[model samples]
Target: MRRRSFLASSSVLTIAALALPIYPARANEPFTEGQTAVLLRLVKDIFPHDALSDEPYLAVVEQLASAAADPDFLQLLREGMSSLDGAGEGDWIDRIEADRIAALKEMETTPFFITVRVSALFGLYGNPAIWSTFGYEGASYEQGGYLFRGFDDLDWLPEPLS
Candidate 1:
């Protein structure tokens, strides 16, 4: 093949590859579809923010899946899934909201539950996109602080004494 043709083709291929979404390559998937579904449900139930979409919860699960690459973490997750599934009637994923909440409450003290709770807290709330929904404008330090930026805009408060 001509050098020019080869270079052009290679460049095209490189650009195409770069344009594609790049997810971290995992040698073995951390969770099966069922497990992933359960994780999604579990994280959503943990937070129960009806205003937010599934994207943030999914991100949390993805983060957890990434952490599950470690053998120990994977084992913990698998065991946790089993315990959750066994705790109540049928699969935990199939349970109604009340049942699921009850099941989660039962396992609240477990390490697995704690890990997921902390992960959900940071994953769901830490996302900048979520901040707007909660009316959190984020840190004001970068914008010269909140002193001049509606610092006294609390309409719910009683008027201050002169």
Candidate 2:
């Protein structure tokens, strides 16, 4: 009888534990595809004509936006923009373009807009898939951990010093 009661109590506790929300998935809200495109265009304008072309920036922005369907990520983005004083800048695309350029200029001596644009250029140029597509082999193997290594094989010491 005592064992049965203990088992019942444990089961209830286990169920409750499982039911608790840790990090709930963000709500699905409509994201304007046009806005995303505009942001991409602005990112491109900021950072144009890298060796890998414009693929890296486009890919990252797309991936980030897709992943940003999560409320947490979107909220973080909103917070970051606010921290950068991006309120009421304009419509979604215009605001992003204007605020991003403004932030860049305000934060650094090297024309802020150009710096971000250059950053986008470098980011896209540095992506492995983009590099692979372009037939460029610089530092290919060095970034393999993030690009290809499977989770089951992660190790700390003696990093694949190849």
* Top candidate by lDDT: 1
Clashing pairs in 1: none
Over 77-157, each residue of candidate 2 has an lDDT whose tens digit, in order, gives 444433444534554345555566665456443232332333344346545676566656666467775355453455665
User: In candidate 2, which residue ranges exceed 4 Å CA deviation?
Assistant: 1-30, 50-54, 78-100, 107-123, 132-136, 139-162
| Residue 44 miss distance in model 2 (angstroms) | 2.3
Q: Per-residue lDDT for 133 in model 1? A: 90
- Model 1 misplaced stretches (Cα beyond 4 Å): 1-28, 155-162
Candidate 2 residue pairs in backbone clash: 46-117, 47-117, 56-124, 104-112, 105-112
Q: Give the deviation of candidate 1 from the true structure as CA RMSD.
A: 14.0
lDDT of 1 by residue, 67-139 (tens): 6766767787889999998998898899899999999999887767866776566667767878999889987
